[model samples]
Target: MKLRELALISSGINERRNPQGTIYYIGASDFVAPSLLNKLIKPSIMPSEKLEKHFLTKQDVIVLGKGHNGFVGHTIVDDSKPMVASSSFMVLRDFHVKVLPKYIAWYINLESTQQELRSYSRGTALPSINRTILGDLEIKIPPLKIQKQIIEIDELKKQESKLTTQLDQLKTIQLELLLKNKIKNYEQ
Candidate 1:
């Protein structure tokens, strides 16, 4: 099914104005973090009250509407705090029951999908991805139960990977300490 069928896709802040209220402004450059927007050093501002509607919420997805050189089609999910997205992104929310936000995010950022989206990118100065192009994408969304299962498994894998890395570091430290102790005894 097309992405539009699974979620409410809309452009973010497209107008130029100064900060009027307390809000976070996220631009294309802020998307330097891939996959998920965990650390956003986005500038804080006081925007118009109306712009509150564009504030990102949990499970919201953001797609870079412009820029290339591995920037276009950059998709990230906002499972974090609410923040305003810049005009450079297409914000997707109100996901259908069948779709998982992270799943869609990961799928969009896939090298193959990014390749296709990049192909549609236009402009000589800066390549971009149009909303229509993104909406027309047919993505396979599994049942909710399956979606949950997939996400859960993926989470476990990530945790395992992290733990493995930490363990490796600890092992290295242990070896270093063992060698140091042996050298001290030999010196004694």
Candidate 2:
């Protein structure tokens, strides 16, 4: 079945605000983490109406709220507490019983989906995606087991990357010690 056939989200642009207490912002710097979901700012206070309306949770997918043109998908699977996002971001609540949010988010991040999103962008000066259009975008769904397997493989890759970094550091130290010994020999 198609992706739109499975998921749900705000029908259109639902511009709202956090309850008036203290507003926290997530800047561009927060998006650099290696995890599938890398940038989430916690707001101290939010409009009770908005808070009740737009609260985020693990497995919820969020898109950039403002500024950046094409950053449209990240799964929030870390924090369990209440946090509000900027108006520029749109959250995709995964209600698809058979589809995994991690897989859906990863699919959106793929080069193919990015190209589709680029075509759907609106606004003259600043580009942004309309929630309605996003909701309607076509996605191809695979079985849930396959989705979980993809996530497992991705995790394995992350572990491999960590080990590679450690290995590289050890090699660097070894080379440094060898060079030091050669220098000492020349002096002798």
- The candidate maximizing lDDT is 1
Query: Would you estimate the TM-scores of all the predictions?
Result: 0.72, 0.70
Candidate 2 local lDDT, residue 151: 81
Q: What is the clash count for each candidate, in the order shown?
A: 4, 7
lDDT by residue (tens digit), candidate 2, 26-62: 3334455433434354453544564455666777776
Over all chains combined, what TM-score does candidate 1 have? 0.72
User: Could you tell me the lDDT of residue 168 within candidate 1?
Assistant: 100
Predict model 1's lDDT versus the native: 0.74
Model 1 RMSD in Å is 4.1
> How much is the lDDT of residue 63 in candidate 2?
66
Q: How accurate is candidate 2 locally (lDDT)?
A: 0.65
Give per-residue CA lDDT, model 1, range 12-67, as digits (tens). 88655354535667776665445444473644666677877887876778888777
Query: Where is model 1 more than 4 Å wrong at Cα?
Result: 15-21, 35-43, 69-82, 156-188
Which residue pairs in candidate 2 have backbone atoms (N, alpha carbon, C) closer than 3 angstroms, thus clashing? 3-139, 18-46, 18-47, 19-46, 19-47, 65-88, 65-89
Highest TM-score scorer: 1
- The list of candidate 2 runs beyond 4 A from truth reads 1-4, 11-28, 34-49, 65-69, 123-126, 169-188
RMSD vs true structure, all candidates: 4.1, 4.4
